[model samples]
Target chain A: MTENPNVPVLCATGVSAIVAGDAGDFRVLDGVSLEVDAGEIVDITGSSGCGKTTLLRALARLLPGAVGTLSLRGVSAHDLTPQAWRAAVALLPQKPTMVAGTVRENLLLPWTLKVRAQQSAPEDAVLRAALDGLHLSDVSLERDTDRLSVGQQARIALLRILMTNPSVLMLDEPDANLDDASAAQVTQATSQFASAGGAVIRVRHQRTDALASRRFSMCGGQLTETTS
Target chain B: MSGAGGVIVIGWWQLALATGLMVLTGALSVALKLGVAKQLAIATARTYAQLLLLGLVLGWIFGLDSPWAVLGVLVIMTGVAALTIARRAPDAPAGTTGISFLAMLLVGTFITFVVTGLIVRVEPWYLPRYVIPIAGMVLGNSMNGIALALERTFSDMDARSGEILALTALGATPWEAAAPSIRRAMRAAMIPGINTLSAAGIVFIPGMMAGQLLAGADPMAAAPYQIVVMVMVATADITGSTLAVMLTYRRRFGADDIYLERGYRPDSRS
Candidate 1:
């Protein structure tokens, strides 16, 4: 099929996944198709078992054993190297994983990876600004990430991903465990990211005011855009 | 000093030393949480008894002066070293069994043979005294190193698989993905030997030097040998640990990049 040239930043078609186990395979995603363009925030809401998270992972090419046609920035997801794909479209998993180190070290982790090693490290001012935009104080940078509260950890996780400067950001329940003020900060940061030409795909159990654009409902592994 | 014929029988003191050694080994075992106190006590007692009996048997073998007996003892020592290494590392993969056995054999044989044969120029018939003790020292150091390496590598891999995958996704090669964890584990594996080396004279007199002195060697004469053994042990520890960690990566991760079996559960008791 001819590709859309508003050429969505991330796209997937006929993507299906099965959770492998000893008993049998349980289908998680089936023929799921969606697209997110630059400067767009796509909110995907579904019940617990509807594979919204799996679909997001499929788009990011992070889901193992997933079968589908997925692409980012007009490049086939399957053809691009994982590093290139991740640099283009990164996923922030449901439970944020913090490497054992200080906040600055965690923030600078993506730079240490060979894929992004050629890129110059972010300046101290830029990193501090990103942290500040997430409502995190400059002092948070010196604290151990493991010692941060859940809300603080979530904000730091987002800041870490943002430091990579990926074109597309897929977050699974970015606001799931956050307090009201932290959730608002996430929404504000994400909205700013979308307005600045980054694609945002968020999976949540309930819709939030954070998503100001299109909203989609995932049911029985099917997605349909709705105004509700 | 007052014994008949002025022989001054100190054999009882040796017996007491042996008893005290058993008690110390048992206490250390308990303190390390290696096993139940009673089980460790029994194991220590059995170990001392076995060593004493082996010494008597070796005395006879030495008196007989047969090449076959010497070969037999070497084979037994190799077998014991291999088995002990394997047992201490139960979580290691089957491939590691061969790796560890070969490593113990190669390192222990190379160091002991080269030191005694080429450097010391001990008589061929005197191989037992030099080769057995040196081999035992090398094998023992390698065993601890391998155990630490295997445990550290696997645990670090397990705990940091996500970080590794993140790195891989970020375009790091396999070696690059594993480099940091491997380095950390290698350092950790080498720490015990490093610490012993650092604290050698100030903290404790190593057993080998103390034993040599007890056997009537001048302290000054025994110093060089102790230093040699320490250097050899450090070499064995570093070489064995790095090799073990390198070999473990092949078994720990699958082709699809998922952790395979529980190859090296760092939490598992040895």
Candidate 2:
């Protein structure tokens, strides 16, 4: 079924989160709301601990204390199973976590999940080609993931989530550990994803958001759209 | 009772004479400035007191010869076993005590009955001499297994939060995400049972079999009893660990299928 261009591919309303701090419980995201339509690349910028990552996590339903009304393609997140909702709207955390295995296995991790079991893994040649597109031709698929540099691991983790073909991709600091060149490559890949009718919401510390059509600034647990 | 094959009963004086060895050990520990001296002395004291109390209780229960008496003692033993596990795994979720109690009570009672009623075919299924000892052995072994599994499951989930949450983000179910840790816990729980089974007759004679032989029972009869016990303990360990871990591992996750970081509540661990 074709998606209505008028309807947002992903939407969140009054997304609030209360996280346990070292001192005690504190509000992280307070009534933060946002919407992203297909082919839109949204950028969320904030100071450290400004609830940027927390908001992304809340949207993905990863935070247990988060309260919000989230919808995907006009369908309520409550209507779908969490597994189904997460598969449709995937999150790539800030830290890159690679399981113990060859790079090929790590890249194919999504398909190995039971929720994604119905989808077959792509061919190694296809994966190798995707790596080449991401300017990671030096990284071999047979190489152990632990041996990869953090930058390489970050890119591979991003590619791994993209392999799931999620409609809305939430990235937390995708370029936190990448060099300028590697960071550019990430931006290019995400731009291509957005242009292909997929939605992208990225958390960035830097002000450069060349691909974003809409920019948001989060402060004191609130999200406000900035006039870019 | 002094015949070559007959049982040898130690008098009270002889039992006191045996206490001298433990006293000597405690003294040696103190002389060597070992910090374990106090623990050693306390353990020795507990061993004597506990065994004598057990003998008194068993003597009374055997005299009563009532099925309700046997069941009551077994239930009390199961409760103690559950409490021991709950104490050992303090980091476990809130309902851990209830879960462990249920698991031990069900598996322990089932295994004990199977041994006394069906395997040995004791004349009276609830005969204290048969039922109490069998229930004790089952509950003791199962308590250790379930405790190990419970401790391992929670610790593993905490340590592997990164990998688990990553899997959940890709839509893995809670079971699928926690499967590795559960398997590891189950394996760790089974190791002692496996070792006991393998070393029973070769490395050392098991307690029940050794007691039987010392009491002048036939070696053939003691061997079958020991075999039954080894098999029973292993079976109980498997079932108890599986039940305890299955019932409790989900405590690490929320109802929305998200893994609660460090269990109980969602924190900023990641």
Candidate 3:
């Protein structure tokens, strides 16, 4: 699945968002714009409540009333169906959502979507291999997701996203719930994804800067590139 | 026709006795600080006024024998019922009131008109006596179901919206993500209709059947009428609730299967 490494896979321009709170209307993302090329890992760092998650969701088109021009793989977001565009630019939320089923069923759910109708699930061997690389080899696909720990759920959620084979990965603190080994595995996976001509945008909480090729800081809804 | 034209009559003295009982209950509520005496009084007064007005209005409609008049009344009734049902919805995701209006009007008219005009074969098709009351019976029950469905669906969204949005993230369509909540809400809404069927004749002669019998209808006629109505009402409830859940849940999600943001969530909850 490797392609030209420097292709501009996703580009955003003039994206702005406002959200209401108990206090009043708050501008969470204001005219934020960026571009992520193939093999690019863009790390977003910010203090809590600095709107990093908001910006990521805006880019993903999950935030309503977020006005922006975004193109993925040369196709404008407006021209693509939300389901179709999301299949290419997936945003992994901060908290993992588990359906009432075994891990296997949840992981295979995306294939059942009409947008992904042309695709089929990865075989069990491939899935197990990917899980093993994420330090989740011991986890059984037959295991109930409800019985999994928070950490396990987080990792499994990432695994499901990867199974979709998205071109752009928007991870909101992807390693927040992981221990050192699992976090390392997560970083390794992101690097591997980028190297395979995919793009990664991680909202990082840690001081580590090795994985991301470029870094941006979010403060008061503005995304500014950091000299890294 | 007189208000108490049936075989059994609630004479004014008997009405006085019932009023006394209600007053006693209200007094007990106030004394015990149950905090509902004022509501009890207001409800009682409103009931009296509303029923008195209804009695006069139905008497006039029945006397008129005008089909267009009856149809107009049904339309207005349906509109009010829909809005009432929607008003009970949760204040989230917007446009729920409009959804209820659409569901209630379509379901209410389809079921009510079909039964009264076709199955019952009420001569003139819009006989005010038959059409108005039957429409009320059908719409009233269906309205409850629609309201319950909207409430359940919307509240479930509040609790499980994150899960729903997560499904959207995985490239599922809005309908696919919301199908679970819609199904659950429809089931919850149908409970009352189901209960009515199970309890109908055995528990007590249903209101319509009993009322008709008291008004001098033969058992032969009353029995079939009750059966037809029971089936019609259950159908109406199921149709109303299902349509409401499906229509309203679809509106909650975005046009392109994105989860429409209601407000801010610190942790990426929809």
- Per-model TM-score versus the true fold: 0.75, 0.96, 0.90
Once fitted onto the true fold, the runs of candidate 3 whose alpha carbons sit more than 4 angstroms away are: A1-6, A21-27, A207-209, B1-6, B27-35, B264-270
Per-residue lDDT for A18 in model 3? 84
Assess candidate 3 and give its TM-score to the true structure.
0.90
Deviation of model 2 at B248, angstroms: 1.0
Sorted by DockQ (best first), the order is: 2, 3, 1
Residues A1-228, candidate 2: write the lDDT tens digits.
246667899999999977766677778898988999899999999999888988887888888878989999988988989999999999999999998899999999888878877788999999999999999999999999979999999999999998778999999999988899999999999998988889999998963867899999999899888965
lDDT of 2 at B236: 88
Per-residue lDDT of A87-131 in model 3, one digit per residue for the tens? 899989989888889988888888878988877778988888878
Model 1 lDDT at residue A188 = 87
Q: Write the per-residue lDDT of candidate 2 for residues B53-108, one digit (tens) a residue.
A: 99999999999999999889988898888889999987677788888889999999
lDDT of 3 at B115: 90
Q: For each candidate, give the TM-score of chain B.
A: 0.78, 0.94, 0.88
Find the 10 residues in a row with the least total lDDT in model 2 chain A: A1-10
DockQ of each: 0.23, 0.67, 0.55
Q: Return whichever of 2 and 3 wins on lDDT.
A: 2
Model 3 chain B worst lDDT run, 10 consecutive residues: B261-270
lDDT digits (tens) for residues B120-147 of candidate 1: 7778834676766776788789878987
Docking class of 3: medium
